[model samples]
Target: MNATLVAVVLSLFSAVAYAAAAVAQERLASRTSDSGVVRLLGSGAWWWSVTLNGSAALLHVAALKYGPLTLVQPLGALTLVAAVPLGARVAGRRVSAVEWRGTALTLAGLAALLVTASGPAPDDVLSVPEALAVAGITAAVIGALSRPGTRPGLRHATASGLASGVASALTQTVTVAATDRSGPLLSAQVIGVALLVAAFAAGGLLLAQTAYRGGLGAPLAVVTLANPVAAAIIGLALLGEGLRGGAAGLLLALAGATVAARGVVTLSRPVPEPAQLPTKEPEEHPIAAELSEEEHPVAAVLALNPQSASYEPVLIPRQPAPAHLTPL
Candidate 1:
C-alpha cells in the first residue's frame, strides 16, 4: 500500500491502542491514592500504557517513512479524539452532554487540520545532545507536575498536558532518529536513541498519572493534543515542513484551535451536583464497621475505605475507656 494509506491505518490503530491504555490508566488512578510519581512507575498498568504507546510510536515512524510529514503528523492527533469515551466506558465514568459536544469539536478540528496540509517534508535528525536536552527538560516538568499530593488545578493540568505532548513529540523524534534514511539503524549510537525514547516515555507516563490525579479530561486533552502538535511545530521549524497556504491557513489555524480548545474546556467541566453521591469510607473504623454490620449492612460498601485505619468491631469482654472517659 501507499505510505499515506499505511499512515492512515497506523494512526487509527495507534488511536485504538492509546485509547485503551488511557482507559486502563484512568481506572487505575481512580482506584488508588498513591503518589503519582510512585504509581507512575509502580503500576503494571503503566507498563501496558508504555507498551501501547511504543507500538503507536513505531507505527508513526513507519508512516513517516513513506508518507508526507503533513499527512503523518496530523493523523497522530486521532489519539486525542480516541482517548476519552474509551476511558469513560471502561471506568464507568459518564460524560456530560457538554463533553460530547466538545469531543465532536475536537474531532472536527483534527479532521480539518489533516485535510489542509499537503506534501511530505524531507527527513531530519537531531544530534544526541539536542534530543537529550529536549527530553530532559520535558522529564523535569512532567515529574514535577504529576505529584499525586498536589491539588488538581489549571497549572497542573496544563503542565501535565504539555508533558504528555512532549512525550508524544519525543516519541516522534525517536522514530525519526531511529529510522533516518542516510544512516545505519544502530550505527554505534542507536543506544542513545533507545534510551531517550524510554526516558521520555517514562516521564510522560508519570505526568499523565499526575494529570489525572489533579483533574481528568482537560489535562488529558492538552497532553494528547499538544504533544504531536508540538512535534509538528518542531518539524516545521527545524525540518522545513511548510505551513501550507497563507492567510487562509492562518485563519483555519485559529478557528481550529478555538474549536479544539472549546472541546477540551467543555469536556473538563466537573459533573453537576444532581449526580453527586456520598462515601463513608473515611468513617468506617472497626467499631463503626462492627456497629454498622449490626445496624446497616447495606451501607458497608458505601462507607468503607479499603485502607481505612478502623477495623470491624469485635466483641471483647470488659474493656473500659480508662479513667479519663468514665465519669469525670
Candidate 2:
C-alpha cells in the first residue's frame, strides 16, 4: 500500500486503541469516590488503559514509517476524537449540544492543521546539551507539581500533561533522528531519548490517573492538547517541517487551533457547583413518627399498616388462624 494509505490505516488503529483505553479509565473513574486515577491505575482498568495506550504508541511508530514524523505525530491527537464519543457512549452519557459544538470546533482546527502541514524535511538532530536541558527542565517541573502537597487530580493531571508533552517531543525527536541514520541507537542519544520518554510517560500517566479523580474529561483534555502542541514544536524545531504556505498559513492554522482549544476548554470547563449527595430534604421520612390522619381510625390503622410495619401489641388480635400453624 502507498505510504498515505499506510498512514491512514495506522491512524485508524491508533484511534481505536485510544478509544478503548479511555473507556477503561472512565470505568475506573465511575467506581471511585475520589479520583479513579490512583486506584484505577492499580486495578484491572489500569492495565487495560496501558494496553490501549501501548497500541496507540505502536501504531504511531508504524505510521511514522510511512509519513513524515511531523505528519504522523500530530495525527496522534485524533485519539481524543475517538475517545470522546466512545466515552460518552460507554458511560451512557448524553452530552449537551454545547459540548457537540465544542467538539466540532476542535475537529475543524485539527483538520486545518493536517492540511497545512506540507513541507520538506528540515534538520534532524538535537545537541546532547539541548536535549539534556529540556529533559531536566521538564522533569523538574513534573517533580515539583506532583509532590504530595499539590492540589487534587485535575491540577496534577494538568501539570503531568505538560511533562508528558515534553516526553513525546523528545521521543519523536529520537525516533525521527535515528530513523535512517546511526549505526545503532544503543548509542548515547537513543538511550537518552528512551530514558526521557520513560520518565515523561510514567509521570504523565500518573498525572492522568490523578486527573480522573473527578471525571475523565479534564485531565484527558489537558494531555490531548499538550501532547500535540509539544510535538508540533519539536516537528518544526528539530525536523525543519513548516506550514505549507509560510506565514499566512501558519497564522490561519494557529487561529483555528486557538478556536479548537477554546472549544475543549469550554467542553471540559469546570463547573462551580459542588457535587451534592442525594438530597433527603424533600423526601418523606422513611419511618414517620406520627401516623397520617387516615391511620387515626383503628380500622384504618389495621388496614393501612402493611405486615412489614406492624407490631403484635403482645395481645394476640382476636382473629382466628388456619389450623396448620399458630402465632407463638
Candidate 3:
C-alpha cells in the first residue's frame, strides 16, 4: 500500500482507539469519587484505558511518519465525534439531544478550519533556547490553569484541553526532529527533546483525565477544537506554512470556529429536568413481610408467656395429673 493509504488507515484506527479510551476514562472518573492519580492507577479499568490511549499515541506517531501533519492531526478530532456514541453504549447512558447537536457543530467547524489551513512546510530543528522558552511558557500556563481553586467544570476542562493541544503539537515537533536527524541516538539535542516530550505528554494525560471529571461534552469539544488549532499555529509560525486561500480562508476558519464554540456552549448549558431519568421508587413486598413475620418464633413465644416475668419458664405444680395416674 502507498504511504498515504497507510497513514489514512493508521489515523482512523488511532481515532477509534482514542475514542474508546476517552469513554473508558470518563466512565472511570464518573464512578470514582477519589481524584488522586495514585488511587486511579490502582484500578484495572484505568489501566485498560491507559493501554488504549498508549496504543492510540503509537498509531498516531505511525500515521505522522507516513502522512502530513495537516491531514493526520485534524483527523484526530474525530475522537470527539466517535466518543459520544461509544460512551453512551458502553456506559449505558443516554446523551442529550442538545449534546448531540453540539458535537455535530464542533465536528463540522473543526473540519472547515483544517481544510482551509495550508499544507505542512519544512521545519528547521528548534534551537535549545527556543525549545526551553516554549516549554517554560507552556508549563507556567498549565500550572496556573490547574490550580486547586479553579472550579471543576468548563473552565477546568478548557484549560486542560489547551494544555493537551500544546502537548500534542510538541509531540509532532519532537517526532519530526527525531526522524529527520541522522546522529547518535543519545545526542544532547535528542535527549532534551525527548525529556520535553515526556513532560508535556504526561502533563497532557493528567489534564485530560482531570477534564473527564467534568462532563464529556464541553471538555471534549474544547480539546477537539484546540488541538489542531495549536498544531496549525506551530506549523504556521515555526514550520513556515501558509493558508490556501489567504483572506477568504482565514474568514472561513474564523466563522467555523465561532459556530463550533456556540455549539459547545449550547451543549454545556444545564440539562432540562425532562432529560433526567427519575429516581426509581423502592418496591413494596407484602408477601415477603408476611413470610418474615410467620418465620420468627420469638413472637409466638412472647404470646404464650404474656404473664411470665423475665422470659423464663415457670415451674407450675401438677396436682391434677398425679390424681389421674393413681387411678391407673
Candidate 4:
C-alpha cells in the first residue's frame, strides 16, 4: 500500500479508537462520583478506556511517521465527529438534533484550524527555561480552572486540552532531539523535556476523565478543539512555526474558532425540561420548594460549587387568610 494510504487508514482507526475510549470514559465518569486516580484504576471500564486511548496514541504516532502533519492532525478532529453518535448509542438514545449540529460545526472548525496551524517541525529542542515557563503557565491555568465555582465538565475539559497540547509540544521537542543525527540519544535536555511530557500527559488524562462526568459530546469537542489550538500557539510562539497563507489564514482560523466555540456552547447547554404541571395553590405562608430533580441548570451550578455555604431556601412572607375561607 502507498504510504499516504496507510497513514490515512491509520488515522481513521486512531480516531475511532479515541472515540470509543471517550465513550467508555464518559460512562465510567457517570457511574462514579469519585475522581481519585486509585479508584479509577480499580475500575475495569476505566482500564478498558485506557487501553483504547493507548492504542489510539500508537496509531496516531504511526500515522505521523508516514504522513504530513497537516493531513494527520486535521484527521484527528474526526474523534469528535465519531464520538457524538457513538456516545448517544451507548446511552441508548439517538443523537439529538442540537448535538448533530454542534458536532458538525466543531468538526468543520477544527479541520480548518488544524490545516492552517500545522507546519514543519521545529529545528531546535525547547530549552529548560522555555519548557519550565510553559509547564508553569499550564499548571497555573489548570489550578485556577479546577478551583471551586468553575464550570464542572467544561473547565476540566479545557484544562485537559491545555495539558495535552503542552505535552504534545514537549513530545515534539524530545522526538526532534532524539532523531537528530548529530545529537546524542538521552541528552540532558531531551531527558528533562521528556519527563515534563510524561507529567503533562498523565495530568491531561486524569482531567479528561473528570471532564466526561457531565456528558460526552460537548466536553469531548472542547478537548478536541482546545488541544490543537494550544499546541499551535506554543508552536507559533516558541518553535518558530508560522501559520499557512499569512493574513487570510489568520482570519479563517479566527472564524473557525468562533464557529467551534458556538458549537461547544450549544452542546454544553442542557436540554430544557418539560413544563411542570400546575400544583394546587397554597394558603398563607408557604415554604419555597427545593430544586426539583429536573432543574438541570440549578443542579449544574450546585455541582460546580459543592462546598458553597451561601445557598438558602427562599421563604415567602405570610399573608392574611381570606375572609371567605372555611376552616379545615
* Residue 263 displacement in candidate 3 (angstroms): 4.2
TM-score of each: 0.69, 0.73, 0.73, 0.72
Winner on TM-score (1 vs 4):
4
Q: Per-residue lDDT of 161-181 in model 3, one digit per residue for the tens?
A: 566555555666566667775
- The clash count of every prediction, one per candidate, is 12, 3, 0, 0
Best by lDDT: 4
**Model 1 weakest 10-residue run by lDDT:** 296-305
lDDT, candidate 4, equals: 0.75
Q: For each candidate, what is the lDDT?
A: 0.61, 0.66, 0.68, 0.75
Residues 1-328, candidate 2: write the lDDT tens digits: 5665577678678867866776686677567756545555568767878888787777766665566545655565566666677876875766656667777877787677666764433336565787887778766767787787676665676676677667656665566667656457467877887787787777776677666666767776776777677667766776565776678888877876787687667667543443688855664332332545433223212233466676432211234457778667
Clashing pairs in 2: 35-213, 37-209, 122-240
Candidate 1 on 136-233: residue-level lDDT in tens? 76656655764556675445545655554554454455566567767776754557756666665555565566556655666666665566666666
Steric clash pairs (candidate 4): none
Off by over 4 Å in 4: 1-12, 62-76, 148-151, 267-328
Model 3, residue 268: C-alpha shift (Å): 4.5
